[model samples]
Target: MCSCILLAALKNADEMLKDIISAVDTSGDGKIQYEEFRVFVEAAERQLLQLFRSIDRDKDGRLNKEELQAAFRRAGLSVPKRRLSGFFDEIDLNHDGFITFDEWRDFLLFMPTNHNGSPLEAAFSFYSSIVTVNPEGDSLVSDETLEGLGYFLAGAVSGGVSRTATAPLDRLKVYLLVNTKTSSNVAIAAAKQGRPLVALRNAGGPIVDAIVSLWKAGGLRTFFAGKLLLGWSRVLSGTDSHAGNGLNVVKIMPESAIRFGSYEASKRFLAAYEGHNDPTQISTVSKFIAGGIGGMTAQFCVYPIDTLKFRLQCETVKGGPQGNALLLRTARKMWADGGLRAAYRGLGLGLVGMFPYSAIDIGTFELLKKSYTRAVARYYGIHEDDAQLSNVATAVLGATSGALGATIVYPLNVLRTRLQTQGTAMHPPTYTGIVDVATRTVRNEGVRGLYKGLTPNLLKVAPALSITWVCYENMKSLLKL
Candidate 1:
C-alpha cells in the first residue's frame, strides 16, 4: 500500500512538474532559457518572501525552529517531533540553529532534484510515521482534515482585514438601513436641527449627507463606532469586567473562517457525490449550492454577533447603551427582552438574504475565474490546464460577484437591519415581524425604502470582497494549498 501511494505521488509530481515547465516556457522552445528561468525564479522568490514574512512574526529576518513549528501548526499541518527534527536538520545547512531566507529557498529549490532522496519521499515517510496503527495497522488522517486548516487561516485573515478596512462604510450602511426614511427627510431633519452640511444635501445626495451627519454627531470616531468590543478589550487587557473598545476583527474572523472552510468542504462533498474526483470538474450548480450552504451555515452560527454589530452601529442613530460597555449592555438588554430569541431577531430574514447573496457571490466568482482562465489560455494559445488568473483578474471577478450578489438580495438586507434594530431603547418596535416590516416599509417609504443603504453597501461590498479574495488567494498560494 505504501509503495502504491509513493508511486502515485511520484506520478502526480511528474505531471505537475511538466505543467509548471510548460507555463514557464513562454517562447514555446520546449526548453527553458536563462531569461525564462530568471523570471520563474523571481516569481518564486516573491512567493517565498510572502511565506517567509508570514511565518516570521517577530520580523527579525530569520526563522527559528519554534517559528517554523508554530507556522506549521497554524496552517493545520502538524509534523511529528522526530520528523520535524529531521526536517530541521536537513534544512538548517549551517547547523547555526536558524534557517535563513537563502537556506530555506535553496532547500525548496533543490527539493525536486535532490539526488540522494527527494523531499517528496520524506513527506510520505513523515505521513506514514505519524499515522495511528489500527487493528490492521492502517490508519491515516483523512484528506478532509489535511485540506482545511490553511483555507481557514486565509479566510480568517482576509475577513478581518476587509471588514476592518470597510468598517466605516459598513457602519454607515447599517445606519441608513435602519433609519428607513428618505434622504430628503433626513436632510430636512438635519436642517431643522442645525446640523452641519445640510446645504449639500441636494448636491452630495443621501450618502454624503449621511456621512456628514455621522461626522457632525461624533466626528471621525463615529464612523468606526462599535468596532472595538468590550469583551475583546478586556481579554486583551487582562481586565475582569470585559469593558473596552476597538476593531471588529474578532467578530469577522470566525465568520469568514467558517464561510470559506465550509464552502471548500461542501464542494468536496458534492464533487465526491457526483463522482467527480477533480475539483475543476464540479458543475456550476454544485458551486452555487455549496456557496449557499456555506453562507447559511456561517450566518446562522454568527447571527447573534452580527445582530450586536448592527445594533451597536444603529445606536449612533438611536439612543442606546454607550461606551466600552456597549456590547455587554446590548447583550444584556437583548437577553432581558427575549432571552436567546432576541439576539437572533432577524436571523430568518438574514438567512433568507444570505442564501441568494452567498450563492451568487461565490458562484459568480468561481464561474468567472474558470472562464477567464480559459479565455486567457485560448488567447495566448496555451494549455488551459496551465493557465492562471492574475491578481487583477481575481480582484475584478471578486468585485463583480460581490456587487451582483449584494444587489439581488439588497432589499432583504434592509429589512433584516430594520428587524434587528427594532424595539431598542430609543426606537420602540414599530413592526412585529418580517411581513409587517416589509409592508410598513413599502407603504410608508414606498418601494425605494426597501433599497435604502444600497449605495454604501455596494461601495463596501465591492472592495471588501475584492480584497478578501485577493488576500485569500495570495495566502493560499503562499501556503502551497
Candidate 2:
C-alpha cells in the first residue's frame, strides 16, 4: 500500500496525488484512518494500472505534466501550450495542486460535464461514460449487449474516418451517374451533323474516371457526399457478420437479452428463428442476418445524402454562367415532379445488393480465418498458455481470411455498382427491365461485363475487409470478455 505504487500508473503527476487522497478519505470524518486508508491504497493501485495501460505514453511506468498534455493532444484536444503550469489546480479539490490517487478518484467521480463546456468536452464525457459502463464485457448486461456496444464504438470511429477520405470519390461517382442524359441532349446537334463529341467529354476513359470527371464538371462541395455513411455501412455490416461468426465458433454463443419498450415481440421472433443459443443449429443463414440488418440500417439512415448525390449529377446543364444553380434547380425539379419517392430511385436494388455483398464478404472472410487459425495452431502446436502469441496469430489469420473473402465476393461489387448506377440514371438503365439490363450487359460487354470492375473491387476491398476482421478479433481479446 505504498503511495508510489498507487500513483505509479498515472504518468500525469497532477491526477496522481488527487487519486490518492480520494481513495484514502472514504469515511465522513474528513480524515483518513490507517486501516481504511490502507484498503483504499490497494484498490487505487489496480485502477491506476488499468488507466496507465489505457493511456501511458512509453511504458516507462511514470508520467510528467508534458506527457499528460500529449495524451490530451492525441485525443484531439486543442489545449493551449502553457496550460500545464496549473493543470490540476481546478481538478484537485483538496488544494494540493498535485493529486494523490484518492483526490484523482474523487475528481473523476464527480466531474460534472453534462450541462456546460465545449462540444468536444461533452463528446469526451459521453465516450468516457460508455467505456466505464462497459469496461470489459459490459457484464452488467449480457454478452450480446456488450457486442452491441462494440458495434456502436466501431461505427463511430470507422464511420468518421471513412466519411472523410472517400467523400470526394463518392460525390464524383454520383455526378457521373446523373450527367449522361444532359450530355446526350447537348450532343444531339453534333450527332445530327455527324460530328464527334468533344475530346474530354468523349466518355472513353476508364468508367470510374468518367464518374469522377462528371463530378468535377458539376462542381459539388465535398460535404461528406456519401463517404461518412458508407464507411459506417462497412463497419456495421462487417461487425454484424464478423463478430457473430467469431462468437459462433465459441463453445456457447451469446444471446442478446436487452430489449427496448416494443422491440421485445420482434426480439422473440428473431430468437425463435435463430433457434435460441443452438450454435449447432445455425448454418449459412445466420451469417446473412447481420449483413442485411447492418446494411439496411446504414442505408436508410443516410438516404438523403444518396438523394443529393443523384441531384448533383442528373441536373440539366443549361449553358451560360448560371450552371452552378443545378442544385436549386434539381431540388425544385424533383419537388415539382416527384416527392420523397423520387429520391429513392434505387431502393429496391439496394436491398438486393446488401445481402450478397455483406454475406459473401463477411461470411467468407470469417470462414477463411477460422480455417487458417485452426491450421496454424495445429501445425505450430500452439496452446492456451501462449495467449499473446496466439492473439497475434489470430490477427494475421483474420487479415488473410479477409483478403480471400474479398476475392470471392468480387462479383458482388460489380452487381452492386450496376444496381446503383443503372435504371435510376437520368434515363432508365440500358435495359427495358431488370432482365433486359442483365441480358444487354452480357450481350455487349460479354459475360465478364457483369463483373466489369471485379479486379479493382477486390483490390479495394481485400485489405479493408481483412483489416476489419483483424480489428474485431484483436478488440475481442483486448477486452477479454
Candidate 3:
C-alpha cells in the first residue's frame, strides 16, 4: 500500500514539472529558452546555498582555497595543493582571495568540472541551452557567426606550427642548396670509381654532411639560426612569398589561407552547379581541379617574394651581407638589372611546380580524411560526420599526404632554388632562364644534382605539412565545428 502511494505521488510531481516547462516556453515551440531556464536555476539556488554554507567552516559566506580544497576532497578527488591554488585562482574571478556567492553559483552551473555528479549534469544542461541555431530550439544564443571561424583558424594555426617545427630541416635544406661542396665531392668520387652507386653510397650522404656542418658552425643551435627573424619576416610579408628574401619566403600562412579558401569556394561552386546541397558530395577530380586553381592563384601572387627569399637565404648561408645591408643591396641589384621583373626571376618555373604540388597535397589530404571518416563510420554504424577521426589519425594522414606530394614535386624545388641563387657573387649567373637552369643542372651534375638536398626537403615537407593539417583539424574541433 505504501509503494503504490509513492508511485502516484511521483507521477503527479512529473506532470506538475511539465506544466511549469510548458508555461515558461513563450515561443510555443515545445522548448524552454535560456532566460526561462535561468528561472529554474534561480529556484534551485536555495538548495545550492545550503551546501555552500556547510563547506564554510568559519561561517563565512565565501570560499577560500582551503574551502575549495575541502570540497574537492569531499568529492573523492585528491588534487595537489598547488593545483588547488590554481583552481582557486580561476574561480576567484576578481582575485580578491575569495569565491563570492555569485562566483560560486556561476562555477557550479557553468564551469566545466572533470568529475561526474548531479551538479555537473546540471551544468551541462545549462550549457546545452545556449548553442542553438534556430528560434524554435531551446537556446539563448545562435552559433551562426562561428560557422567559418573553425576552418580558417584551423588552417592558420596548423600552418604556423608546421613551419616552426620543421625550421631545422628547412635550414639544412637551404644550407645544402647553397653549399654543394659535400655533394660535389660525392659526385666526383662516383665518377672516379667505375661503380657510381657504390661510390656514392660510400661517401657520406647529404644528411651526414649537414649534421657535420651544423655541428662545426654551432652545434644544434645553428639549425635555428635566423629562425626568429625569418619567422616574423614571413608573417609581415604576404602568405605566398616573403618581403624578407633570405628566409625561404615560402611563408606557409598565406598559402594555407588562400589555398583553403579557394578550395572551399571552388568546391562549393561545383557542388551548387551539380544541385548537391552537401559540399562533400563533390567528386575527387573536381576537388583536384579546385586545388590546382587555388595553388596557382596563391603561388602567382607570392612568386616575387619567392625569388627574393631564395636569394636572401642563399646569400646569408654563404656569409654575404648580414642584415639590413643585405636587403638593400639585393633590392638595389635587382632594380638596377630589371626592376620589378628582376625580383620575379624564376616565376615561370615556380608556377609550373606550385600547381601540381598544391593540387596533389590538398586533394590527397581531403581524400584520405574522407576515407578514414568513412571507415570509422562503417565500423561503428554511424553517420560519416559523426565518425570524425581522432587528432592523431588526422595528423598522420596529413603528414603522409605532404610527404608524397613533396617527393613528386621535389625536382622543381631544386631547379627553382638553383636558378634563384645563381646570379649571386659566389656563383656567377649561369642560367638565362628556366630551360637554361634545367639544362645546365643536368649537363653539369647529371639528374642527381637537380635533387641535391631532397633528403632534407622530404624530412621537412612531411612533418611541416602534417603539423599544419593536424593543427587545423584540432582547432576546428575545439571551435565545435
Candidate 4:
C-alpha cells in the first residue's frame, strides 16, 4: 500500500513538470530547440545541478550557488569555506566576478556538469536542436570533413610559419613533413637527460637531411640547429615589417603634427567613442585582431606559392631540382606533369588550416602580451594604458608568445600536407579523389601511415611559429591594425 501511494505521487509530479515545460516550449514542435527553449529554465537547471546532487532548485536549467546554498540550508548541512569561494567565483560564470542572467544561461547550457550528463551527450542533445535542411535526415557531415578541418588547421600553421620564418623554416618543414610516425623523441627527452647527440637525424638524403633529422628527433624547444640565425631573422623581419607599415599608416594621416602611436590612438578612440564603449585599453586589442586578419589574407592569397614550395620540396627529396632544372623549369614541369588542377591539389586543406592556426596563435600572443604588460606595469606602478613605450613592449611580448602557440600547434600542418599532397599524383591508374586517396593510404599503410613526416615538421615549428607571431605582432603595432 505504501509503495503504491509513493509511485502515484511521483507520477503526478512528473506529469505536472512536463506540462509546465511544454507550456514554455510553446512552438509545440514536440522538441525544445536549444536556442528556442525557455532561457530561464536552462539557466536555473545548470545552477541547481552544480550546487547540489539531489534537488533541482530554481528549476532554471543549471545549479548555482543560490540553489546549492538553499539546498544545504534546507538540509541543515554546513558549507565549507573553500567550497563557498569556488562557487562564488563561478556564480557569474563570465569570469567577470559578477553574475548576470546571460552568464547564468550559459552556465546552464555549457557547464560540464548538467543533465543527460556527459559533455558529449549534452552536445548531441544541443545538436538535435539545430534546424537542419535535411527533410529525410540524410544530410550529414562525414568524418572526412572533420579530418579535412584538422588538416586545414595544420596547413595554415605550416604555411603561416613559412611566411613568417622564411628559408630555414622551409628546410625544417620538409624534414617534419616526412611521415608522422617517427617520434623517436630521444631528441626532446634527451635535453632534460643531458644527451643532445641522441636527437640528430641521419645524413645523405635530401638538401637539408641532417637538419631535418635533428628537428624530428628534438621536437620544438630543442630543435634549433640555426637557433640564433632564426631568432635574428625573426627580429629583422618583425622590425622591417612593422617599421614599414607604421611609416605608411602615418604618411597618409594628418601627420604635420601626428605621430605613430598617436595616429593609432586617434582611430581607436573614434571607433570606441562611436560605438559608445571604453577606448582606453581597446587600442591595444585592435592591432592583434588586425594581424590575425593579415595572416589569413597572406596565407590564402599567396598560398599557391606555398603549394608550389611544398611540391618542390617533396620532389627534391624524390629527385632533387635536377629533375625540374630550376624554379621556372619546375613550375612548368609541375603544370605539365599534373595539369592545372594538380597545382592546387591541397587548397581545401590550406583553407581549413588558416582559421584555427591564425586564431590560436594570434589570440595566445595577445593574451600573453596583456599579461606581461600588466605585470610590468604593476611592478613599476605605472597605470597609464596608453603609454607609448608600454604599448610597443606589449606588442613585442605578444609576438613572442604567439610564436610559441604556433610551435605547439604545428603538427597539424604535417598531417594536412600528407593527406592533401600525397597519393594519386593526378596521373592515370591513380585514384585522384581526396576521399579515395585518403582511404587507400589508410588501408595500405595503417593509421600511422597517414601521419608521415611529422617529426621534422615539429622541429621546424618552434622557429616558424616564433617568426610568425613576431611578424604579426610587430605589423599590428606598426599598422595599428
Clashes of each: 1, 25, 7, 37
Which tens-of-lDDT digit does each residue in 1-481 have in candidate 4? 2212322334233443454456456577787677655474555466534543453455554445555445544543333333343444543545654444454344334323334543323422232322121333344453223323333333333333434344444445554444333334445566667775654542213325545544444334223222223233432344321111121121212111122222233434454665633332444445444334444554555455545544444333322222224334546665775766666665665545554555456555656666666676787786424223443564355446545545544444544455334532211123455566567656755665554444444445545455444443344343222
What local distance difference test score does each model get? Answer: 0.72, 0.42, 0.64, 0.43
**Best candidate, TM-score:** 1
State each model's C-alpha RMSD to the native. 14.2, 16.4, 13.6, 20.3
Candidate 3 per-residue C-alpha lDDT over 54-159 given as tens digits, one digit per residue, 9 for 90 to 100: 7687877887876766665554443334335545664577999997877767644422222255452333333333223223433333332234444555565666
Q: Write the per-residue lDDT of candidate 1 for residues 151-185, one digit (tens) a residue.
A: 78888888877877887888788767777554455
**lDDT agreement of model 3 with the native:** 0.64
lDDT of 2: 0.42
> Who is ahead in TM-score, 3 or 4?
3
Q: Model 2, residue 206: displacement in angstroms?
A: 2.2
Poorest 10 consecutive residues by lDDT, candidate 4 = 248-257
What's the best-to-worst order under lDDT? 1, 3, 4, 2
Task: Tell me the deviation in Å of residue 384 in model 4.
Answer: 4.4
Residue-level lDDT tens digits of model 2 in 28-78: 566779888667645644654455444446665544455555555555554
lDDT for residue 318 in candidate 2, whole number 0-100: 25
Candidate numbers, best TM-score first, in rank order: 1, 3, 2, 4
> In model 4, what is the error at residue 399, expressed in angstroms?
7.2
